[model samples]
Target: MLIEVEDDFRSSSDKAYEKIFDMILTGQLKPGEKLIRRKLAEKTGVSTIPVMEALLRLEALGIVESIPYRGSRVVPITKEKVRDWYALREAIECQVMRIITRTLTEDEIADLEKLANKLDAMEQAGDTEGEEFWELHFEMHMIMARKTGHQSLIDSLHRINLFRLLQRAQYSATEHKNQIPKDNHHCLIDALRTRDPLIAEEVMREHIYHSDSMI
Candidate 1:
């Protein structure tokens, strides 16, 4: 009986965490917005315990910060922070490119090419800010990372919640539309096809810096 209750509590906490995480990523919960436990509990339709647990988890991930007496608030997005994330992403993903250059199968390359084409089409349509666009963008990157067969790299990216960082960067840099080339992802795939780690790393660096320049 106790184990079942524990499982129920864990399930509720996971749901609350996912809901709150999505809210943050989708910009429904803006940076610096205070998270009231009672309000979140009511919103998530869960008890305060689960909501609190979710907030604590987010806090650990650097997405939320608790003030001494002010409760918790979403971490504010800033150019400096975004740049830091960009640098971290570049470091991790450049290595991903280097590793996958030697190991990525032809089928994997084709899959990546398909996703790149979709991303290019979305860019041409000027639909970059939509949730669907960002989701696909995240998926594309995750596919590359997964192709490297590096669990640690995958976990690092997930731990940092790179998708949320990308969304926050995009939201903060609304003035920088059309800065990224529509063929950016296609170019990346071409670099990967070269099977030269150095070439792939250089392309990856340029790709990441394009987004970093926006902020």
Candidate 2:
């Protein structure tokens, strides 16, 4: 994520936690893959103690789990779990978009357009840097939610951001990802511009559904 802390706000364990979390969320570590703390320490250039600390945090977050006799591993993503998370995310995000549509300013619209264009540019370059795109795209959605002036909703969205990005990344190179990202952004922008809460919520709901299905 953003490692630009003026001071090191993250501890060694926190850094290890974030690294492992990133791998798990991006499907790099892969669901159900065993996490060997020693190997992870060597790979990440940290100590096994910190890796252990990180794994514990991950377990609490439901991103990793221990098998009692088999050590720990990344949690497998199940269809049911995806559906449940989407149900929660969609409900929260749609409400945020509805509020945003009624109160967004011209400057905010321009900022969103820039973020969407950046995602498009990254995709068009054939980099398939889904991780980069995923983070930025997630931030754009959070920005929209935050602009709604609801701290509670923003806090809720923060907790689900990584999980949602994991699901969204599954849409990359799917059977029909073409223009879906760009088009979704365009539709969202239009809704905001028109100050149409109905349209904004509808478009956001549809977009999230399509992305979730790809997962």
Candidate 3:
């Protein structure tokens, strides 16, 4: 009976986490917005316990921060932080491309190509702001990290990705009108297929830096 109760609690927490996460990603919860646990619980139709658990998980992921005696808020977005994130992301993901170039199997390459094509189609269809597009975009990069079989690299990318989504949401909330090039992923995939680490790294660096103008 206790185990069943625990499972129910966990399920509720997971649902709360997803709801909160979606709210943030969809820009309904802007950066640095204060999170009231009771309000969130009411919004998510869960109890305060689950909302608290969800916030703790988001805090662990660096998406939320708890202030002393004040409660939690979404992590603030700043130009300096965005630059730092880009730098770290370039360092990590360039290495990811280098590793993938040397180790990725033909089948894996094909799979990545397929995913990239789907992303291109979505972008061409003007669906960039949708949640599904962002999810797939994250998945596309994660697939590359997984190909390297490096758990540390994958974990780092996972954390970085959450911030990336937040950055994108913040950007969209602004007046910037720059659109990501439609051929972006296609170009990266082409470079990776060259099987040259230097070439892949160069392309990946360009790709990462391209977002600088958006913020």
Candidate 4:
């Protein structure tokens, strides 16, 4: 019975988290918006405890920020933060690309190419909401990062990815910018296929810089 109670709390927390996360991503919760536990609990049909737990989880993801003696709010994407994030992302991704180029098999390269094609179709279909576009974008990079066979590298990239999502959410909340080009992924895949680690690294650097310009 004790274990059952614990499971129930965990379930509620997870549900609250997913609900709140979707709300932020889908633009239901705007940037810099103050989050009230009671209101969120009411919105998610959960208790305040679970709502608080969900806010903590979102804070960990960089999607929400907490201030001492104040409260938690959705993280606002600023130009400074965007620049810092892209720089860190470039450094980590360039190294990951180098490692992937050295170890990626043809099958993996082909898979990435397939992802590029899908992204192209998504773009052409005018995914104005950007949810599908960013999901596929994250998927393609995650596949490349996983190919490195380095757990630490994968973990770092995942953390950075959370910030990327935050950035996208912020963008979606305000202006719709064509920051990431549909062809950029295709370019990176082509660079990997060249079998030159240097070329791949260079392309990855340029790809990340493009994101900086968009910000």
Candidate 5:
């Protein structure tokens, strides 16, 4: 039997966590917003304990900070995070692009194009409400990285994705002052489809660097 989780237990906390996580992701919860215990519990429809549990998890994820006897708050954005993530992402994505270009099959590239189309539709329809674009976007990166056949590197990158998402989301929400270039994503896939890892790496780095500038 597939056991369904109780809606009012620790699952409540998990549910609360997910809601809070999305709020942060979607820019609903701006940086430094205090997460009051009673308010969070009432807002999330979970108990205070579950809300605290949720906040604890966010803190562990480096997205939340606790205040003494008061409550937790979302961490404010810092340029250092943008700088650090740009350096880290450049290194990881460059190697991943090389791996992808070397061995990814034609069918794999086709699948990526399909994913890109979905993302394009989302972008065009303005459906990027929260994490709507994240799953597809992250998978696009992951598909290339996974082709490396380096499980350890892939695993490490997965851990790093939290911060990457944070930085990108923060940039999009709290820092962006203009529209993202519409053609950059398509151009990236074009480079990959042509089996040009050099251009592919360059485009990915450029995108990250561009995001850094906006942040």
Candidate 6:
């Protein structure tokens, strides 16, 4: 039943959306890079209609902006924007951590550890491109929100995470470096496992804002 639901959400247009989203998050599509519908359609192996649909979706997510004469452009990253995102994340996720500290299951903790391990291995294996890192990083945070048993919080965090991904991509490209913090996920997982809301909240707040100085 769950598998069917997941499959139903993935459609032909979703392929285009995922491809375009990946391109933006992986920095293949630079900030302020112009998005031409025909070129995107060709790149995603989809019709122009679906490509346009995907662009519309991305634009609604605040990842793609439309220009009157220039079509769509990837939103540029800025220190102010990154700070705003971190502030929002801290506001929402700190409360989420409070719930998780009391409610996170042993199974969830084990899964988070595995994710952190995989991320560490990827970094050790010279994952300079950060494609795998980006995916796992998003998954780790989403898992935390999911374990909180709060659907609304999960949805809100998902939107913020998407915006954060764009900012991260642009920051990495502009600085010519990956901004993934070292072992931050491991520290966060450990804090969650402690079953102490204060500890978890502090760790999460620090983890989310760790990049603030760089911005």
Task: Estimate the overall C-alpha local distance difference test score of candidate 4.
Answer: 0.78
Model 3 per-residue lDDT tens digits across residues 87-158: 888998999999999988888888899989998888777767776887888889988998899999987898
lDDT, candidate 6, 32-125, per-residue tens = 8999989998999989888888888888777889999888999887777777777888888998889988987798789889998787666555
- Return the TM-score for candidate 3, rounded to 2 decimals: 0.81
The alpha-carbon lDDT assigned to residue 58 of candidate 5 equals 82
Q: Which ten residues in a row have the lowest lDDT in candidate 6?
A: 1-10
**TM-scores, each model vs. reference:** 0.85, 0.73, 0.81, 0.82, 0.66, 0.73
Top-TM-score candidate index: 1
* Position 40, candidate 3: lDDT: 99
lDDT of each: 0.80, 0.74, 0.84, 0.78, 0.72, 0.77
Task: State the lDDT of candidate 5 residue by residue for 120-185, as single tens digits.
Answer: 666655666456577777777777778898886675566457665655555644324235566546
Write down the lDDT that model 6 would get: 0.77
Q: What's the true lDDT of residue 191 in model 1?
A: 92
Compose the digit string of candidate 4's lDDT tens values, residues 60-120: 7677999888889988878887787778788889989988897888988898899988876
Q: Candidate 2: what lDDT? A: 0.74
Candidate 4 regions off by >4 Å? 1-9, 120-130, 172-183
Error at 124, model 4, angstroms: 6.5
Range of the 10 consecutive residues with the lowest summed lDDT in candidate 1: 1-10
> Which candidate gets the maximum lDDT versus the true structure?
3
> Which of the two, 4 or 5, has more lDDT?
4
Residue 56, candidate 1: C-alpha displacement in angstroms: 1.6
lDDT ranking, high to low: 3, 1, 4, 6, 2, 5
